[model samples]
Target: MQFIINQISSFLKPDLTILALGADTRQRVSWTQSQKIYSLSPKKDLSDIRGFYFQAARFLKRAFRLSPDTITFDPHPNFVCKKEVDSIRGSYFPKASLAPIFHHIAHAANFGIE
Candidate 1:
């Protein structure tokens, strides 16, 4: 995951804090600073949009000291995860940049594929 993040960092803004929204089944949030990840949420099944939103808000407010300069989400148009992320971005971090990654590429990279 670190290697993949390193590779992808080239396409992202430098010196910016990032919040990464994990895939749907094992939903989680990662707070990234200086290329390292600090998990803000435990891996769990997020069953509904309201639950996800509530947890995300709690994590963002309680876990991290700084607001994210950017947020990342899986690039699947119909994905509920993406919709949730979009809601967060719109409601809380409207000025932050969004970096949507290709779902298959992220999956392959997680397995150490180039």
Candidate 2:
């Protein structure tokens, strides 16, 4: 939880936050949002904390400047990530836009790879 607190301390008022939810072997919650240039993939399988993560994500959206229409997710239909993302989106940001992007693409984009 200390890490979360530290993260809060950092001045990251993101305009968008992408939830990297896929690649079954390692179900993580990552983000490569705009307007605050940073990426975060907590060192744990966040799929287990689906509820908590969304709650916090909602908070991030409300508390910080995170955009309301850019809650993204993976496009892989079979991954549990999609289901949870649907649930989170429905329960939290129902009107948010879908910005589907692959996990590999996000990672590769980090290093300027196309």
Candidate 3:
């Protein structure tokens, strides 16, 4: 997340306004409305993640109407492995701007004392 934030702060020019689609810049570390998410956990049976992703993609296609650039959060399969960075690139986001935000980085930073 810090990496993404840094990219936004550093890479994007000051004049260009950044419209974050799937994330809430206000909350920073938490979820917020208007940000759509599709979670595909093998454990859960109710919400089919892939199905939802397709739906979101369709919606985006219509909503964007062929915008120049788009950024999204698509986790890689190697997210569980030590190589949390590479998996998603091979599987999902070969094209288009994508960011991999590490949950553990945040968790470890916020770990509570027992």
Candidate 4:
């Protein structure tokens, strides 16, 4: 139950709604168009991935109101979340496009230099 949820909102017009999922370490859930989420991560250790999953799932169902047209997730083969992509997608965005993104690139795109 120890985690952090930070939502930063802004503006950026986009054709399709996009959801960006972070790697296991930061374990964030974010989106584009800037109005929904800035970044959502439960402040916790990587070793406790089980708890992370539960919290993530709960947060996903609770906070999200719209389904993204595309879903992007970290593709680390070893991470539990990577393997659980189906459940991660779950009733949340069954029709969304799911794609794999490199950890560094994904982070840079969102948290990188301007």
Candidate 5:
């Protein structure tokens, strides 16, 4: 959390923040009272916290005047609909180019992504 605060503090007055989200293997499960209890039991996988991560990303984006875009399984594993990506795109950068950039692969080029 401190890392996020530091990031927001360092951004220029006007800057872009791209936040992304994805579901982990653990999150690809059904939610139940037992699951909640298990989660609180400290025996649940921390990997299941995908939802919170996305939530935090959104929070930080707003705090730093940034934009958020998330990625998730196209045919989501645990849900009937797969719309987070399109929702984010529509809400944040509706007019921005919808180019498919291999972001992770371009971690050293211009802006750390060509």
Candidate 6:
């Protein structure tokens, strides 16, 4: 998975550092720096709401330290990961844009789909 992210990062050439919040199931936090991607392991499921927010807070702090230029979350509207990103956007990352990437599209990209 890490290798795949690395390859995508190289190909995309995102101009700004990015933070990606994974889906509700195996919640993950990934960030990029100089085309190198780093990701936190899958944590608790975000469907639990409270627990998901707590863990998300921690990961957000870690991601913030990297001063991400953009923040991405799963497109699932009900996903707690999306809520978490929205909450932080108001306070921690007011200038950063919130990008909601569709879940399946992300999966396909990771698998090397065009």
- Give me the candidate number with maximum lDDT: 4
lDDT of 3 by residue, 29-82 (tens): 111122322121122232333343333334433543322132333243432222
lDDT over C-alpha atoms for residue 95 of model 5: 40
- Tell me which residue pairs clash in candidate 5: none
What lDDT tens digits, residue by residue, belong to model 1 across residues 62-112?
544547887877878777667777678777767778889877766774553
Error of 3 at 99 (Å): 2.0
Candidate order by lDDT, decreasing, is: 4, 6, 1, 2, 5, 3
Instruction: Give the clash count for model 1.
Output: 0
The RMSD of every model to the true structure, in order and in angstroms, is: 6.0, 5.4, 11.0, 3.1, 12.2, 5.1
- Per-model TM-score, in order, reads 0.66, 0.55, 0.33, 0.70, 0.33, 0.67
lDDT of 4 by residue, 1-114 (tens): 555656655555645677766666666666654354556666656676645765665665566564677778777888766787677677466778888887778657776321
* Model 4 residue 28 lDDT score: 65
- Candidate number that wins on TM-score, 4 or 6: 4
CA displacement after TM-score superposition, residue 88 of candidate 3 (Å): 11
**By TM-score, who's the top model here?**
4
Show model 4 residue runs off by greater than 4 Å: 9-11, 33-36
Native-to-model Cα distance after best TM-score fit, residue 26 in candidate 4, in Å = 1.6
Worst 10-residue lDDT window for candidate 5 reads: 31-40
Question: Which rank order by TM-score, best down to worst?
Answer: 4, 6, 1, 2, 5, 3
What lDDT score belongs to each candidate, Candidate 1 first?
0.61, 0.52, 0.29, 0.65, 0.32, 0.62
- Would you give me the overall lDDT of model 6? 0.62
Q: Please identify model 6 stretches exceeding 4 Å from their true place.
A: 1-9, 12-15, 42-64, 112-114
lDDT of 3 at 69: 30
**Which candidate do you rate higher for TM-score, 3 or 6?**
6
What TM-score does candidate 6 get on C-alpha atoms? 0.67
